[model samples]
Target: MRKLALSDEILLKVEKPARYIGNEVNSVMKDKEKVDIRFAMCFPDVYEIGMSHLGIQILYDMFNRREDVWCERVYSPWTDLDKIMREEKIPLFALESQDPIKEFDFLGITLQYEMCYTNILQILDLSQIPLFAKDRSEEDPIVIGGGPCAVNPEPIADFFDLFYVGEGETQYDALLEAYKENRRCGGSRKDFLQMAAKIEGIYVPQFYDAVYNEDGTLKSFVPNDPHAKEKIRRQVVVDMDKVSYPTKPVVPFIKVTQDRVVLEVMRGCIRGCRFCQAGMIYRPTREKNLETLKKYASEMLKSTGHEEISLSSLSSSDFSELKGIVTYLIDEFKGKGINISLPSLRIDAFSLDVMSKVQDIRKSSLTFAPEAGSQRMRNVINKGLTEEMILEGAGKAFEGGWNKVKLYFMLGLPTETEEDMKEIPRLADKVARRYYEIPKDKRNGKCQITFSTSFFIPKPFTPFQWAKMYTMDEYIHRAHVVNQEMKEQLNRKSLKYNWHEADVTVLEGVFARGDRRTSKVLLEAYRLGCLFDSWSEQFDNKKWMQAFENTGTDIAFYTMRERGKKELFPWDFIDAGVTKSFLYREWERAMRGEVTPNCREKCSACGAMCYEGGVCFEGKN
Candidate 1:
């Protein structure tokens, strides 16, 4: 029997002791002496949130399948456990083996969002590992980071020895095999990193140097080591059907954020929304085989016994075989009291009909993400949604017994005017008006139209990457404009408006487009106690401000500055399938308020054709 990392006394004190305990259902176990590599896969957040991530689940299942590799999971302890561990001087440990993380061979952290930056330091600090990669010894785990944030690894490059620069299913086997070979040859730590750098999609930050011009724009990023390539092309999986899927995912004792079985129907998006980073990075959308998905749905549900199943994708409706798979799922499990969820679907007759079958009409609300309020602003962002479409969708839902409607929009978009801001509430009012158009005898109760707006932040691999951001005051003013306009509507009682905190959005913007120079500010902020910035209760904007002031880092430089046409970005060295020229051309189109067609409608020559698969070669021989 394995021993517990925390004592009974300590476990009794924490909120969710099950989070620290190992041996959950479906968690793999192996003898330490039998496995050649003990990998510690981490999601740098609390257990509940980390357990909900699909990427971690997929990678965990993939890693544990190898006989020589025993992968264990670790999540950042909550604040209560964090304080106790610090006071007791206990090192962070993995859940499966109940062993200290410092004893592992690799510490793979997924960078899912910008707000989780400080939590990465928290994980390192508690594990007694060196916070910076340069200070680590051979005994310490080779700290690596991946996921969507890996596209812009420069902001946190100093802290990670290496970064796996794309889809984990592609090159992880090569990386692990190289590590095994290096160990068998008795190579030094740096020698192993040099070997790892030779593999595609692997980035060794220490081997590369970034030079900045006097104006702080990136001058050049060249690699010093011969093994390190000049450009690290993102690894992509051309054949989605061939990759392993996590059918038997581990079941947590506590309720997680996504407490259901998730079936990823596709890998990429056909809709080319200009402000979307995922759509740009994951090009040439690929859908899973319908037969394969039907098989996995049964297997996952059988394994985890989850009542609800959600179809995961950038755009679930865009899946070519969505109707077929959904029909199969409903037919296969309808009588067994199973629930099906479909998100990211466009609001239309077919979608409404499908959702009506799966979801309870009276209890559920319909959601529409117009992204921008006005048609002109929608064109600028390439939302491809019009006010007429939104109202028509809402009208259908209202007639179909969905009285509650949720609308999402973005504030501070590039070239957003006062008319655009006011259009947000006006659009909501229009939806409410459509709801009241129904006769009182046939309609549900009073209609509730809720609309939320989040400030736009320019992300790394999007057409908006070169766009400028507004100050905190400017953002709040825009939200207030929308709020004030809501009161003037005829059905103001049915309309509700809310906006996100400007401070956090501003900080996220800085981190989203930040360079290596922002690392000092991050270090200082973590030292001053800034963990879980995404959580409302724990976020301290005052501490962040002090960190910036102490580090002499100006936030405006990252957020408010306009980029020249030829200015090089920090992520220029990464070739993420989508050409920079294509992105720039899209940016030009966005500035002209010209709408570019999605992948299915017409090929825009975005340079993802090099893969020669997926949507790019959908119909061709």
Candidate 2:
């Protein structure tokens, strides 16, 4: 049994003591003396939330499979425990070993969202590790970051020793081996960084310097080290079926956000939504083999004993074997009281039928992400959804007995106008009207429409990366416009309108497009006690604004200013399989309100074909 870092008195006082105790089923535990490398895989969030992430589970399983590596899980201490840890001077420890993270060989933090930036610093601070990579001693672990947010890592680059620019399954094995070799050779931290930089996906930020123009635009991003590659090409797993997945994922003692068996049906997206970063970064969509998926699903269900299972994908409806897979799960677990959850599915006749069979029509609400209000706005964003299709789908769903509808949209997309903003409420009214069109005898109950709109943040690697972001006031004004329009509707009593926080949206925009200089702002924000910025109640916009003021960093330079056609971006050094020329063409098409077909419909030659596999060549001769 591993001795815990927290005392019995402290454990008794915390809200969820099980979070710090590591005896959870499926959690890997090894003798540290027998391993060459001790990796602390950290998710800078609370235990329940972190354990729910599939990426960490995959990587944790992969790392532990190696004989030389012992991987352990670490999550940010909850606010209650954080206060006690700071006061007690107790170092942050891994759940498996109950050992300080400062003693680990590698401290890998997944940059899943922009809001988790401050929490990264909190993790380092609690571990007794230096916040800045440069300030760390040789005894400190090599802190690295990966995940979707790493596509634009310049904002937090100063904190990480290196960043893995793409999928974890691609080059992680080689990275670990290289680290072991370097350590055996008695290499210095700088020497190891140089060695790591030579790898395809590894980016050592210390070897690169950013030059800014007088106007605050990126003048140049040049590599200072000869060993560092000028362009860090993102690594991708071409074959989704070949990668290692955790069949025996850790089952937490406490309930989590997602407490079901999660089957990753596919990776990447075929639809090239201009505002979506995941669509761009994760190019050339790949699907897992149906048989392989079925096997994993069976094994995972048996191993974890989860009562429910969810299909995860960018677009679940786009999967070619979706029906087969869904049918398999439904038939296999029909009488077992197992529930099937399908998210991100397109609303159509086929999907509606499948959903009606799997779920209770009266209790379940159908969801549709039209993304934009009007057809023209939808075309601009390449959502490939039109008003006719939306209304038709809604009518079919209503006929199928789903009276409650949930509509999702983005407020400040590129080329958005006042008319487009108002169309959101109008579209919801149309859905409600369609629901009421059903005969009273056939209807489940009163038609209910829940409308949600989140402010758009321009992200790197997307067509909208060069687009301007709205101010907090502008976003709130837009939301207010929609709210006012919603109030005037005949179904106002049945309609519920909700908008995301404009303040948090603006901060996310700043970090999304921010350069290396933005690191100082992040550091200052962390110093001012900015942690868990993603949590609405914990986020303090005033402290973040003060951090910007203290750092002398102009927030507008990263968020409000639109980029020139030929201007260099801080993230341009990375080639995310998709070429810049293709992104520019897509941006031009978005400006012209021209919709591009999805990869399955036609090959747009977006340069993701460089991978020579996936949907890029799925239908090609």
Candidate 3:
């Protein structure tokens, strides 16, 4: 049995002791002496949130499949455990092996969101690892980062030794083999980083230098080492079906955010929404084979015995084999009393019919992400959703006995006006009016429309990357406008309005488009007791503002300043399968309220077709 790093006294004091204990169901265990490479896969968040992520699970299973590599999971210690570890002088350890992360060969952290930046520092501090990559010794772990945030890694570049720029399924095998070879040769840290830089998707920030202009904009970004690629092309799995997926995922002791069998139906998205970073970064949609999905689903369900299964994808409706997959799942698992959760599905007659068959109408709410209030604004964002489509979809859903509808929208999108803001309430009111139009006996209950809006933050690689974000006060004011509009509607009693906190959105914007200089602000903020900024209660906007003030950096410079058409971005060093020229063209089109068809309808030739697979090449042979 492995000895736990935490004492009984310490475990008893923490909120969730199960989080610190190892040997959870389905968790991989290996003999330390047998494995050559000891990897600590870290998610810089609390256990409940981290364990729910599917990416870490997939990578953990993949790494451990190698007999020579022993991979373990680690998450940020909660405040209670963090205080205890500091007072007791205990180094943070991984869950599986109960060994300090500093002793591991690689400390791979997934950068999922900008809000978790402070938490990343907390993890390093507790692990007794150097906060900055440059100060680390040869004995230290090779700290690497990956995920969506890595596309714009400049803000936190000083902290990571290297970043995997794209899909882990494509490049991790090569990276691990290279690490083993470097170790076999007794190579130093510098030697390994140099070797790693030569790989297609690996980005060694130390080998690149960013020169700034007098206007505080990036003048040029160039490679310092000859071995380093000038532009790191993001790695992509051309054939996703060939990649290994975790059929028997680790079942956590405590309930997690997504405590169910998650079937990843596909990767990438067909809808080219101008404001969405995910749509841009994961381009030219790729899907799994229907037969493969059915097998994985059955295997995963049998392995984990999860009572529910959810289809994971950007848009579940966009999957070419969605109906076939859904039908198969229902037929296979319906008798077992298993629930099927389909998130991110378009609200259509077919979807409504599917939902009616799988879920209890009164208990489940139908969700639609129109993204904008009005058709013109939707066109501006290239959302491909119109008022007629939304109302018609809601009408069909109401006719199918779904009384509760959730409408999602974004405030402060490019070209948004007061008229656009008011249209949100107007649109919801129309849906409510349509529900009333139904015969009294036909309706199950009164229509309840839950209207929610989040402040839009321009992200790197998106068409709106150069667009300006709204100030905190402006976002709040926009929310108030919508709130008042909803109150004045005839169906005011049926409408419920809610908006996200404006302060966090502003900070998210700063980090989303921030450069290397933003690292200083991050360090200072962490020093001033800023961690778990994503959690509303733990967030302190004043402390973040002070950090910016102390560093002499203007937050507005990143969030509120609109960039020129030809301005070089801090993240230009990477080629994320999408072309800059294509992004700029889309941006111009967005300004003109011009809508672009999805990949299945008409190819925009966004340069992702360079991969020559997925939806881009679906019918072209």
lDDT per residue for candidate 1 within 357-425, as digits (tens), equals 999988999889998889999999998887888889888888888999999999999989999999999
Clashes of each: 0, 0, 0
Candidate 1 achieves a global lDDT of: 0.91
Per-model TM-score on C-alpha atoms: 0.98, 0.98, 0.98
Each candidate: RMSD to true structure?
1.6, 1.7, 1.6
* TM-score of candidate 1 versus the correct structure, residues matched by position: 0.98
For residues 1-621, write the lDDT of model 2, one tens digit per residue: 678888899999999999999989899989899999999999999998999999999999999999999999999998999999999899999999899999999999999999999999999999999998999888999999999999889999999999999999989999998988898999998888999999999999999999988987889999999999999988888788888999999999999999999999988888899999998888778889999999999999999989999999999998889999999999999679889999999999999989987897889999999988989999999999889999999999999988899999999998899999989999999999888888899988788999999999999999888899988999999999999999998878889999999999999999888888888998999889899999999999999999999989887777888888999999999988788888899999999999998877777878774323244342212
Q: Candidate 3: which stretches are off by over 4 Å? A: 610-621
Write one digit per residue (lDDT tens) for candidate 3, span 1-621.
679999898899999899999788789999999998999999999999999999999999899999999999999999899889989999999999899999999999999999999999999999999999999999999999999999999999999999999989988888888888998999999999999999999999999999999989999999999989999988777777999999999999999899999999988888899988998888767889999999999999999989999999999898889999999999999889999999989998888899898998989899988888899999999999878899999999999998999999999998899999999999989989999999999998778999999999999999999899988999999999999999899998999999999999999999999999999999999999999999998899999989989999998899889999889999998888788898999999999999998877777878784323344452211
Residue 390, candidate 2: Cα error in Å is 0.7
The models' CA-based lDDT, in order, is: 0.91, 0.91, 0.91
In model 3, state the lDDT of residue 41. 96
